[model samples]
Target: MTNTPSNAAREESLDLASIPPLESIPPQLGSPGGSLPAPTVDAGWNTRTKALEVLAILALAYTLFFARAVLLPFTLAVVLALLFRPVVRYLRKRWRVPEYAGAAGALVGTIAMLIVALSLLALPAEDFVRGLPEKLDAASVKLNQEKLFKSFVSMQKKLNGAGDLGVSTETPAPPRREGEDDEEPEGDDPDYAALGAAGPGAAAEVRQAGGVEVEEEDEPATMVVEERPPSLLNRVFSSAPEALGGFALAFVFLYFLLAEGDAILNNTIALLPTMAEKREAVGLTRAAEKGVSRYLMLVSAINAALGVCIGIAMWLVGLPNPVLWGVMAGMLNFIPYVGAFIGAGVVFLVAYLEPDFGLLDAAMAPLCYMCINLLEGNFLTPAVLGKSISLNPLMVLLSLAFWGWIWGPTGAVLAVPLLSMTKIVCDDVESLRPLALLLGPRIEKDDSASDSPDAESEKPAATAAPAVAPAA
Candidate 1:
C-alpha cells in the first residue's frame, strides 16, 4: 500500500507536468477558454464584394438597354425560329426536303400569307384614308349640332377666358391715318392701281361717268390649299427599306437557327459540366419551346376567329371599313389585355364617327367587341391552353408593363410568350421553383382541411378504434 501511494504520487507529478498550467496551455478554437478568432471579420471585403455584384447587375442591364438595336432582331429571330421550327421539321421529315430549303420554304410561305392579307386590305385602307377628311367634317358638324356638345364647348371657352391660360380674346384697334380722325374711309375705297390696271376700259368708263364706278362683280376668293403632314402609316412605309433590311437579317438568323437547331442545341448541352445538368438544360429548353409555341398557335387561332366575328358583325351593322377593323383587331390582339381594350376603342371611335349611324347603332360595334373578347377570355382560352400556360393575372400585367417599358409595342406583344417561357425554365430549375410558383395562378385546395391537426387526430382515432363484436 505504501509503494502504491508512492507510485501514484510520482504519476500525478508526471500528469501535472504534461498538462501544463492553464495559462501556458494553448487555447483551442470553439473551446470554453477561446473564441474562433472573432470570425476574421473582413467587413470591408464583404461590402466591396456586394458592391461589385450590384455594379455588375447594373452594367448588364445598361448593356441590354443600349445594345437593344442589335439584340431586338436576334431575339425576334429566336422567337420566330422556335415558332416555325415544327413546320420546318415536318417538311424535312415528310418530304425529305433539305433543312435549309425547308426552313426557307416555311418562312417564305409565312411572309407570302402576310403580304397577301395586306394586299387584300390595301384598297380598303386607301379608301379609308381618302374618306377620312369627309368623315371628320361630318363628325365635327354633327357634334356642333348636338346641344350637349355645344354646351360643353361654351363652358370650355368660358373657362379658358376666365383662366390665365395665355388665350387672348380682345382685338387690337385698327390703325388710324396720320393727321386724321379714326373714322371709316368714305364710300367704297377706290380699287388699287394694280387691280384697276387689269380692266383699264372699265376704269376709264367709270372716270368718264363722273367718278361713279360701275361696280365690277366681286372676284371669287382663291382657295388656299394647306398641305397636311403624312400619316403614321405613310411614315412607316417610307422607312420600309430599313425595316425590310432588319427583317431580312432576322429571317436569315431564323433560317440558320432552324437548319442547325440540333447541332446548336447539342453544342449548348455539351457546354454543361455534367450529363445531369445537360439533360436538365435540354429538358428546360424543350419545355419552353413547346409551351411558347403551343400558346402562340392557340392564341393566333383564337384571334383569327375573333377577327372574323368582328368583321361579320361590323358588316351587319353597316360600319365602314369592316375589314380594316378586323385586321386591326387580329393584329392588336397579340398584345393581351391592353391590346383588346385598344382594339375595342378603335371600333367604337369608328362606329361613332360614321355619318349615317345613330348613337345606338354606334354602340353596337363596341358591344360586339366586348362579347367576343368575353367569350374568348372566359371560355376559349381556358379550354385550349388549360393550366399549362396559366399565369397569375398580376404577374402577367407586371410582365407586360416591364417588357413594354423596355421594348415598346413589340415587347408588349411578346410579353406573354416570354413570361411563359421564363416560367417553364424556372419550374425546371430546382433553385428557381419558388419563382415558378409565384408566377402561377393561385389554386384553392379541397384537401386543405384534411391536412390540419384536427384531421390528423381524427384519422388516428378512427383507424385505431376496434370494431365491436356483432350480436350472435
Candidate 2:
C-alpha cells in the first residue's frame, strides 16, 4: 500500500475523516453525563397548565349557558342557512337571482307558508285547546277507574299514611266534653249585615271578651280578594312579544347567513397561510355544510313520511285530529330518541281517551307510530345517511344531554346537528382524528399504530438477525 493511491485507501481515509471524535459526539440520553437533559419545568407547572385548560373549558360552558339567548338564534340560523343553501343556489343559478333576493324570497315564502298553514290549523287547534280541559278531566276519571291506576293511587296513599283507599282520611272533630256549653260563643259570628250597612265606615267593635274588645275594619266589597287566573288570550299575548322577537332575530341572522355564507367561507379559507391549509379549510367547511344539510333534509323528509304514515293509520283507526298528530310527529321527530316516544305517548293517550277504544285498541296507534319509527330509524336512515353523517349512539345521547342542559329543549333539537358539525371538524383535523373516530358510529382499530418508530426499528433488526441452524 505504500505510495499507492488505491480505491480502498481513499475510501478508508474518507470513512476515518467522517467519523466524529468522541469529545464532539453528543452523549446519549440516560447516560451519566448526557447533555443536561432538556430542562423540564416543574411538574407543578404541568398540573397548573392542565388546570388552566379545565378552567378554560368550564368558562366556555359558562359562556354558552349565559349567552344562549343570542347564541340559540344564531345557531338555529346557521343550521337553517345550511339547509336552505341548495335552494338559494338553485334560485341564483336558474334565474340569475341575486343572493340576497333569493335568500329573502326563500325566507319570506317559508314564513308565509307557515302563516297560512297555521291559519288553516288554527280552528282545529283552538277547538282542541278549548276541549283539552274537559278531555283531560274525562281521561283522569277513566284513568282512576283502571285497576292499575287505582292500585298506584292506593299505594301512594299507603306510602303517605292516608289509611285505606276507600276510607275518608280527614281528621274527626274532637269529642265534646259532657259539661261543655257548645253554644256560648255569641260574638264569634259577628253580623255582616251591620258591616255592610256601614260600608267603609269606622271599625266595628264586637262584644267584649275578658274585658278586651276586638275591632275589625271592612274593605270595599267591590275590591277583589284574589285575582282571576290568566286567560288563554292573556297568556298568548304575554308570550307573543318575546317569541316574535326571537323569530325576528333568528330570521335576520338566517337571511344574512344565507346571503353571505359563501363569501364568508371563501374569505376564511383564503386567510389560511398555505395552499394545503386553504384546501383543507375549504374541504372541511364544504363537508360540514353538506353533511349537516343533507342529514337534516333527509331526516326531515323521513319524519314527514313517518307523519304521513301515522296520520293515515290514525285516520283508518278513526282517531280524532289525525293531521294534528301527523304534524306533531313530524315536528317532534327533529329530537332524536325522545321525540318518537313523546309522539307515540300522546297518540296512545288520545286514543285511550276515546270511548270506543279498549286498552288494546288504544295501543294500536302508538304501536303503528313506533313501527314506522323503527323502520325509518333502523333501516331507512342508515341506508340513506350511510356513514358520512353517522354518529355514535352513545355520543348522540351525550350530546343531547349536554346541549339540553346548556340550552334546554332547543339545544336537544340542535344536539345532533351540532355533533355532526363537530365530527366533521374532528375528521378533517389530523390531531383530532382520534376524537372523530370516537364520535363516529364504528370505532375502527388503528392498524397504523404498528407502523410506529419502535416497530419499524425492530423490523430491520429482526430481519438482519443471523439465522441459527439446528445441529442434528
Candidate 3:
C-alpha cells in the first residue's frame, strides 16, 4: 500500500511533465492532443484569376455593346460557318469534292432562298405597314364614337343636378339618409339634387360635406392601360438605304466566310506549336464543327416543320395571307422567345383586321401560340434534336437574352450557336472541364447495358454472299 501511493505520485509527476501546460495544447482535431497541421491554400491564383476574369468580361461587354453595329453580321457569319462546316467536311471527305465548291453551294443555296423569300413577301408587308396609321385612326374613331363613351357622358350628367350642360340631362342621384335601404322608391328617397342646388335642412347638412368626383370606372382595365404601336413608316422609308446596304454586305460576308471556313480553321489551328496541344486542338475543332453542324441541320428541319404546320393552321383558320404568314412565322421562330411573340403579333393583327372576326379571331391568338409551340417543343424538338446539343435551358434562355440585348434581333439569332461553341470550348479545356460537364447534356454511363446480351441480340445478322473456293 505504501509502494502503490509512491507509484501513483510518480505517474502523476510524469503526466505533469509530459503535458506541460493546457494552453500549449491544440484544440483536439480527433482525440485529445491530436491535431492536423494547417492545410496549405493557394488563394493567390484564384484571386488574381477572378480579378482578371471580371476585368476581361467587363471589357468584352463594352466592346460588344460599342461594336454591335458592325459585329452583328460578322458574328452571325462566323456562327453560320461553324454550323455549315460539317457539311463542307462531309462533301470533301466522302464525295472527294473541293471544299470551295461545297461552301459555294451552301452559301449560294442559303442566300438565294432568303432573297427569293424576302422579295416575294416584302411588297405585301410594306403595304400592310404603310396602312397601319389609317387602320389605327379608324379604330380610334370607332372607339370615340362607341356607346361606351356616350354612357360616360350620361353618367357624368348626373353630377350636375339640373340642366347644367343644358337640355334635360339625367337627374342627379338622390342622397340616402343613414339606415335608408338602397331599394327604396325615388319619392321616398332624400333630395340630393336639392343638396347640390340652393337648399337648407338635410340639403344644408350635405353642403357642409365635401363633394365626391365619381369617375366612370366601367372601361376594361387593360384598355385603359393599352398604348398604340409607334408608326414606323417614315423611319422605314428613311432607313431603307442603310438597311439595303447592310443586307448587301451581309450576303457578301456570309459567302466569304462560308467559302473560306476550312482555310480559316486550318490557318488558326496551324499557328499552334507542333505538339500534343495542336493535336488535341484539332480534335476539339472537329468536334465543335460537328456539334454546330448538327445543331444547324436540326434547327433547319425544325423550322421546316414549323413552316408547314403554321401554313396549314393559318389556311384552315381562313386567315388571309396564310402562306406568307407561315413563312414569316418559321423565319421569325429562329429568334427564340421574341420569335413566338412576333409570330403571335402578326397572326393577331391579321385576325384583328378581318371585320367580322376581329375580336373573335383575336381571342384565338393564345390558343394558336400554344398549339404551335407545343408541336415544336414536344414533338419536333425532342425527336429530331434528342441529346445532340445538350444546352442547359436556363443558360439557353439567358444566352438568348444576352445576345439579343447586345445585337438586337440578329444577336438573338446568333445566341444558341455562340453558347454551344462556348460550351464545346469549355469542355475541351481541362481547367474548365467541370463547366463543360455542367453545360453538356447530362450523360449516363452504359457499363451495364454495354455488356448485356440483349444489346448484342439487338444487332442485325450479317448476310453472306455465295463463296467460291480459291482452288477453282
Q: What TM-score would every model get versus the actual structure?
A: 0.72, 0.70, 0.63
Measured by lDDT, the strongest candidate is 2
RMSD of 2: 12.8
Q: Cα lDDT of model 2 overall?
A: 0.81
Clashes of each: 0, 0, 0
Clashes of 2: 0
Pairs in steric clash, model 1: none
Query: For residues 91-194, could you state the per-residue lDDT of candidate 3 as single tens digits?
Result: 88999888778888887787899889889888877777677777776656654565867788777777665647556668989887697664413333454453
Question: Of the pair 2 and 3, which is ahead by TM-score?
Answer: 2
Q: CA lDDT of each candidate? A: 0.79, 0.81, 0.72
Q: In terms of lDDT, which candidate is stronger, 1 or 2? A: 2
lDDT ranking from best to worst?
2, 1, 3
- What's the CA error at residue 96 for candidate 3, in Å? 5.3
